[model samples]
Target: MDNASLKKRDLAVLWHPCSQMKDYERYPMTPIKRGEGVYLEDFDGNRYIDAVSSWWVNLFGHSNPIIANAMKEQVDKLEHVIFAGFTHEPAIDLAEQLVAMTPEGLDRVFYGENGSSAVEIALKMSLHYWQLAGKPEKTQFIALESGYHGETTGALAVSDLGLYKAPYKPLMFDVMTAPSPDCFYREEGESWHDYSLRQFEKMRELVEREHKKVAAIIVEPLVQCASGMRMYHPVYLSELRKLCDEFDVHLIADEIAVGFGRTGTLFACEQADISPDFMCVSKGLTAGFLPLSAMLTRESIFQAFYDDYEKLTAFLHSHSYTGYATGCAVAKATLDIFQSQPVIENNKVLAQHMAQATAHFADHPNIAEVRQTGMILAAEMVQDKKSRTPYNWKERRGMRVYEHALSQGALLRPLGNIVYFMPPYVITPEEIDKLADIAWQGIQLATKD
Candidate 1:
C-alpha cells in the first residue's frame, strides 16, 4: 500500500501514544514498511536513517542477524512457558549472566515485561521491603525535579515531568521532589561540578529531614533522557550515594534508557563507583528484539521477604511474560555481543566524532546549548542565547526540525525545543556525518522566522 493509504487506514483505527490526534491533520504519521541496519524504509521505497534508535532501544541495528537468529532458534524449541511454576533454560542462563555482569552486590533479579513495569516493581519492592522490616511508615518516594521514569501508576507518581504527569495529578500519589542537578542551567562562570554540589545540598537537606518516611531516592544517574536529556556531573551521583548510605535509605537507579552502552560506560553508575539498591534495566536488554525488563537488587533486599508462605513474607509480583524464553534468548545475545566485541571502546570513537560534528551548532544564533553524553547529542533551541531563554513550547520549534529531517530522509525526533541524536551502535561514521548535517540544516529551518 502507498503511504497515504496506509496512513489513512491507521488514522481511522489507531490512536498513537504521546501525541494529540487532531495534530495528525497537519503532521501525519510515516508508515514504515521495513528496517535494516540503521535505516527504515517506507512502502513507497523512501528511506530514513533510524535515529533515536527507535525510541532508544535498537542497539546493534535494525533486524540484527545475531539477535534475530537467536530468537528464531528459541521459538523452535520453546516460545514461552508459565514462569510462575515452570522454569526455562534461557531465563536461567540470562539471569546468571546479568548477575555476573552488572555491578557488584546486585545478585538477584526480578523480571517485568516493560520499562514502566520494571519501575513499578522497584517502587513496590522498596516499599514492601521497608514495610516488612518494621518501618511501615517509610512509604514515600523522592524523585528529582524534571525527572521522567515511566508512565505506570506508581512510576508516574514519582515522575516530575509536567508534560506527562500534570494532567493526571489528581490520580497519582503524592511524591517529594528534589531539585535536579542538571548542569544546563549552570551560571555563566560556574563549573558543572560546583553547580552540581550546590544542587546536592537541597537533596541532602530533604533526606536528612525525611529519611524516616522516604522509602527510596530514585535517580537516572548521569543523564536524564526523557527530560530532554538533561545531564549532570558524576560527582552528584557519588555524593547522593553517600547521602543515601548515611540516611539509611535505598537508592534506586533507573537505567532503562541509558544502560547497555548508551552512555560512555557499560552502566552510568560505574562512573560514580556506586551500586544502587535497585537497578532497573530494559530497552536495550533484548537489543529491541523483544519486550523485557529486569529489576536487579542486592541480596540484602532480596532476603527481606525470605520466610515461609505461612508467615506471608513472600514478595508477590509476577507478569504473564516474566522471564520469557525468546526475550531472554535475545537478551543473552545482546550481552554476548557486548562481551565478545569492544562496543564501549568503539562508542568512544563515535562519540568523539559526534561531538566534533555538532560543534558548529555552538555558533548558531538560536542554539542555547550543544551538549552530549556518549552516543547521545542534543541541541537546545532558544529565544535568547545570552540568557538561555527557551523558545515558547506552543511555537512547536522542535516539530519544524522533525518535519525538515523527515523531508531530508532522516528521523530526528525532538523533545520540546531540543533536537537530539541517539543512533544505534552499528551506525557508521559516515552515517553520523549525515545525521549531523541533516540536524544542522533542520535546526536552521526550525529556528528561522
Candidate 2:
C-alpha cells in the first residue's frame, strides 16, 4: 500500500509509543518500506539516514547480512523452545559468550524480551537475593533523579523521569532518587571529573544512610541516554562501585542503551574499570533485529536462590520467548561481527569526524552544549545561551528540528531540545558529515524564533 493508505490504516488500528495520537493529525506517519545500511526508505521512496539507530538499537546496520543469514539459518532448526527445563545450542552458546566477555563475576544470565523486562528481571533478582539472604527489609532501590529505566511497574518504580512516570506514581513503590551527576548543570569553571565527583557525594550520602533498606542502586553507567543524553565522568562509576561494596548494596548497571561498544568500550562500566553486581543489557543485544534482553548477575546472588525447589528459595521468573533460538543466533552473529571487524577501532575515527563536523555548532547562539560520548553526540538547544534557559515543553522546539530534518532527507529526532546522532556502526564518515550538516541547519531553523 502507499504511505497515505498505510498511515490511515495504522492510525485506525494502532497507537505509537511515547507519542500523542493528536500530533498525528499534523504529522502523518512515515511508513518505512525497507532499510539498508544506514538509510531507510519510506513507501513513497523518500530516504532518510537512520541517525538514532531506530531508537538506539541498530548497531551494524539495517538488515545486516551476517545477522540476517544467521537468523535465517536458525529459523529452520529451532525457532523457539521452552527455556525453563530445556536448553538450545544458540542460547547456550550466547550465554557462554556473554559470561566470558562481560565484566568479572557476572557469571549467570537470565533472559527477557526487552530493555524494560531486563530491568524488571534485575530488580526482582536483586530483591529476591536480599530476601533469601535474610535481609528482607532491603526492598528499596536508589536511582538518579533524571534516570529513565523502563515503563513497566518494576522498572517505572526505579525511574525518576516525571514525564512518563508521574501518572503511574500511585502504582509504583517509592524509590529514593539521588542527585543526577549530569555535568551539564555544573558550574562553568568546574571540570567534568570535579563536577561528577562533587555530585557523587549526594549518592554517597543517600546510599550510606539507607544501605540497610536499599536493595540495589541502579544507574546508567557513563551516559544517561533518555535524560537528554546526560553524561558524567567515569570516576562516578568507580566511586559508586566502591560505595556499593562498602555498604553491601548491590549495584545494578543499566547498560541497555550504552553497551556493545556504543560508549567506546564493550560495556560502559569497563570505562571505570569496575564490575557491577547486576548488569541489564538489551537494545543492541540482537542488533535490533529481534527482541532479546539478559540480566547478568554475580554467582553469589545466583547461589542465594539455588536451593531445593520445595524450599521456596528459587527465583521464579519466566517469559514465553525467553531464549528464542532465532534471537540468540542473531545476537551471536552480532557479537561475531564485533569481534571480526574493527568496529570499536573504526568508531574512534568516526566519532572524531562527527565531533569535527559539528564543531561549528559550538558558536550557535541558541546552542547550549555540544556533548559527546563515543558514537553518541548531542547538541542541547536553549532559549538564552547566557542563562542556558530551555524552551518551554509546550513550544516543542525539538519537533521543529525533527520536521526540518525530514524535509532535508535525514532523520534527526531530538530529545526535547537536545538533538542527538546515534547512527548505525556501519555509517561512513561522509554519511556522518551529511547528518551533521542536516542537524546544523535543522537546529538553526528550530531555534530561529
Candidate 3:
C-alpha cells in the first residue's frame, strides 16, 4: 500500500501507546520500512539513527544474523510446544546459561510473555511463596514513588506513575511507595550518596513497620526507565539488600530495561553486588527479535511450591507459549553473541565517549542536569537552574525536543523533560559523536523555535 493510504488506515483503525490521538495532527508517525545497525529507513527511504535502541531493545542492532539464524533453525525444527507437559533443549540450555550468568543463588526460571507478565509473575510468585511458607498475611509490595513496572493490573498496582496507572487505582491492589533514586530532584545541597542512604533508611523503616504485610520490595536498580532514568549510588542498594534480609522481605529487581549490557554490566544488580530474591528480565533478552520474559528466582523460593499435586500449593501459572522454541533459540544465540563479541567492554568504551560528549551540555542554559550510568544517559531541562525548576509538563518541552529530533533524522524519545539515550551496543565511537551532534542540534531547534 502507498504510505499515505497506510497512514490514513492506521489513523482510522489503531490505538497507539503513550500518545494523544489528537496530537497526531501536528506530529504524525513515520512509516518505517527497514532497519539495520542502529538506523531506521522510512517508507519513502529517509534515514534516522535509532538512538534509543528502538525503545531500548535491539541490543545487537536490528536483526543480527546470528540470532536470526538461530530462530530460523528452531522454527524449521520445532516451533513451539506446551511448556507444562513438555520441555525442550533450547529452553533448558538458555535457562542454564542465564543461571550461570546471573548472580549467585538464583537457580529457577519462570517464563512469561512480556515484561508486565514477568512482573506480575514475580509479584505473584513472591506472594505465593510466602503463603506456601505459611505467611498468607504478606501480600502487599513495596515500590518507589514515580517508579514504573508495567501496565498489567498486578504490575500497575506496584507502580505509582500517574500516566500509566492513575485511572486504574480502583481495581488495583494495595501497594506502598517509597522515595525513588531521583537524585536530580533531591533536596538542594544534599549529596546523592547521602540522599540515597536516607531514601533507603525510610524504606527500611516502612518495611519494619509493615513487615507482617509486605511480601517484597521491587526496584529498577541503576536506571529507573519510566521515571526519567533516575540513577543512584551502589551503597544505597547494598543497604537496601541488607534491610530486606533483615526484615525477611523478598527483593525483586525489575531488570527489564537495564539488563543485557544497557548499564555497562550484564545486569545492573551486579554493580551493587547484591543478589535479589527474584529478577524480572526481558526487553533485550532476545535482542528485540521476540517478546519474552523470564522471572528468575532463588531455589529456596522455588522449593516452597514444590509440593505434590493435591495440595494445589504448587505455584500454578503457565503461558501457552511459555517456552516457545524460536524465542529460546534466539535468546540462546543472543547470549552467545555477548561472549563471542565484546558487547559489555564495547559498551564501557561507548559510555565513556557518551559521558564526555554529554558533559559539554552540563552547563547549557536550558540544561538542568545530565545523569548517566554506562550507555544510559538523561538530559533534564529546567526553567531555573538555580532552583532546579522543571518546565511545566503541560508546556511539553520534552515533546518538542522529541519532535525536533525526529524532524532532524534522529529518534530520541523523551520521558517528560528528560531526553535520554540508550543506544545499541554496536554503536561506534564515531556514531556516538553523530548522536551527540544530532541531540545538540535537536536541543537547539527545540529551544530556538
User: Can you give the TM-score per candidate against the true fold?
Assistant: 0.99, 0.99, 0.97
Looking at model 2, which ten-residue stretch has the lowest summed lDDT? 300-309
What ranges in model 2 sit over 4 Å off?
none
Q: Which stretches in model 3 have alpha-carbon errors above 4 Å?
A: 187-189
Q: Which should have the higher lDDT, number 2 or number 3? A: 2
405-426 per-residue lDDT for model 2 (tens digits): 9988888888998999999999
Q: Per-residue lDDT for 37-117 in model 1, tens only?
A: 999999889999988999999999999999999999999999999988899999999999999988899999998999999
- Estimate the TM-score for candidate 2: 0.99
Per-residue lDDT tens digits of candidate 3, residues 1-449? 55577788889999988889988887888878888888888877778888898888789888678888899999999999999878999999999999999989889999999899999999999999888888899988999888888989999899878878878889998889888867876787888888888778888788889988889999888778888888887777899899999988999999999999888889999988999999999999999999899999998888788888998887778888898778999999999998798888888888999998878888888888899988899988887778778787888878787787777788988888888989888888887787788788777666553
- lDDT order, best first, reads 1, 2, 3
lDDT scores of the candidates, listed in order: 0.93, 0.92, 0.87
